[model samples]
Target: MHFSIPETEVRSDENGSTYVAYNIHVNGVLHCRVRYSQLLGLHEQILSDLYTFFVYEVRKVTKLFYFLPVVRQDPILGSSEMFNSFLRKAQQETQQIPTEEVQLEIYLFSGQKVKVNILTSDQTEDVLEAVASKLDLPDELVGYFSLFLVQERGDGGCTYVRKLQEFELPYVSITSLHSPNYRIVLRKSYWDTAYDSDVMDDRVGLNLLYAQTVSDIERGWILVNKEQHRQLKSLQEKGSKKEFIRLAQTLKYYGYIKFDPCITDFPEKGCHVIVGAGNNELNFHVKLPSDQMKEGSFKVTRMRCWRVTSSVPVANGTANPSSSSKCDVKLELAFEYLMSKDRLQWVTITSPQAIMMSICLQSMVDELMVKKSGGSIKKKKRLNGSFQRSDSQQAVKSPPLLVGAEVFTKLSSVSLRGLSSSNSASDISGNDFHGNYAFEGIGDDDL
Candidate 1:
């Protein structure tokens, strides 16, 4: 709920009118952009509203009213400092607001939805547990499920999907963004499916895939030689849905970049680079016909910056020489090592690889930043990179909230029942709950 008025930048429109654009960051995340005119209008609105509220009091023949200036005679309210001061006051007022219940629409992967009321200040874990109970998930099976906030963008637009991590911010605040189109989806088998399968089938032939020696298959790196490429193509031709799903479900934090160190300099040699993340470090290795070995890598904590550059197609040997407009964009990723700030280590990767690497690096950096800031790391306890399942029983005996039922009706029923029982203290606010039930566009909704 924090707000900040950061530095403004000069921007121009198509009509050539330039204005100062303010960057409004909320809790370190970019919320929205506002122009100088918007700030002026905001100040005017605040002044008008406040003046209207105090007009009658100011008109009294009281000593306090004598010192009050008329609206027309008041000091200017549309300055940068005035706008900032108003924002600061507003931020302080927002913190004083009491925590209230917020209704969240929980969407299931099977396209069904159930509504649940949760407090705004409730932690994400509490919301998840409530969701799990609503979904009829047993204690043992609940570990496989995870919640994701889905922002459904307009048709053909990009949809943003964010996994609700255990240590994430409160559930209510995250849903407030794009509220109309936002939904909390319950995804089953949400953990790393590939790793889970590998663990379960460790005694099988897949063991070769995770072998330690260079001659054997490496766990994280993908072998992209001609033989494997042919094998993948053959598997594709066979078109077995199970096999395809197995291949596609093999997840990697850092995507495999196939590159050959010896022939990587000569683009015509068809080299590739394979990369992986291990123990807070980025592992870059080269896969060759005869031998596979580590090329080079650096700990993510040691990186200060990541710079990317694009090159002309002609310079890259992979591009077709005859067609000038051919798809031949070669991307270069450069890392500024903290220990050696004077020089940067760079690598050539395709556009897709560059994007994947950037995403992985950014995620790692964000986590490292959190750790450096001394935020508690509440990672799920794991044995060999896998979570250990808990065997405790779930408290709920029956479905807490019935699906396809009106939320208010169910809540009212429970509150009334609890009032008659000995558990009256555990019920929601007796008469206040019904009065405070505020639903946005709830009339047309069936539940």
Candidate 2:
């Protein structure tokens, strides 16, 4: 995420205690208010996660040189302590691949290799077709084979296989961590029964995919061992039968649990914000005891920037009774939000329970951004007859930051054509094709 620190304002509470409030802009929009301490905490968490991801990625590379006995015996290359230092050089070499062309090696089921030259913009389908044509495979049998990206892990094994989506294309630059030239295996698809079953099972990496999905909710990579999984199963079994069914269904369909702290609001009571991804967009709802409400949502891809801020409450006189100051320390979000209809507006979120909600949404958006940019960039054009407005009258960019009802006006102006309402608490977790990954109950919002 792109971020910048803006001017600071010193805010004082009723007791005259003051703190410096830092204004941060995310994606060129005022996103939120945060103090120094909160920034430090968030930074620490982010750094820890990055460190782990980097280490895991680097460990995968070390496996490539494992068989070179002479290289291991060399003092500079052999020492475990020097792995971190060599990781930098390895990454640099990977990134140095020529920009115009990429070399790909296809590993066949019979332990054969075929090298191909292709442009970075080439689609995955082209590779499959090329391979099939070379092998003289009939059209009927073509579907039996699938291409897989062989990614290594921190465990010193090439067990991670990322299945390429039909729509996916190779990255244009080798500098990207996901550059396609690293490794590609043109083996029989899961339908093929002739290959080594053990190697095929390892290539699927269903456990790793589930772990990654769970990390999205848990906000960190957690190695849930067999014992912990058993405990979770036991707890679900002892509780409501419906809960157990739901848990089993979630594991079967989505391959992850819905126990995110931000999703549940953990220890905090009262009404809280609910956020989820749907149809290339972010949807939010507020759940209360009496009623459920739609807080409105913005397109995940259009958010140009964001910032966070915090509220400092001062002690008030007992008789005056400012309980809000004592119980509700709000975390505000300021962001440049892009509406589905191409309208742009500045958004600020100040709900006390929704402070961490921004972080959760941010993570989902990062993934969406990657997928959206993976292929060709599609430029959407306005229809000729819709609303009948002239091209000159249309807005090329969103106006300056708008707050309050105006923000809602810009957001609601966009049509909600295929949007549907479902009971998230009761519905069984499934593939998120409809974009409702989280529960949506309605409640009133002070915003």
Best by lDDT: 1
Q: What's the C-alpha lDDT at position 436 in model 1?
A: 11
lDDT of each: 0.38, 0.36
- Compared with the true structure, model 1 gives a TM-score of 0.33
- C-alpha-based local distance difference test score of model 1: 0.38
Which pairs clash in model 1?
A: 257-273, 257-274, 258-272, 258-273, 259-272, 259-273, 260-272
In the range 61-159, model 2's lDDT, one tens digit per residue, is 232111112222222222222332232222223334343677656665334666667655454556666666665554444444567655544543342
How well is each residue in 5-103 modelled by candidate 1, as lDDT tens digits? 323466677799986655443322333446656555654565565565434433441321111112212222211233434443333233333468877
Q: Could you give me the TM-score of model 2 versus the true structure?
A: 0.27
lDDT of 1 at 99: 63
Model 2 lDDT, residue 247, Cα = 42
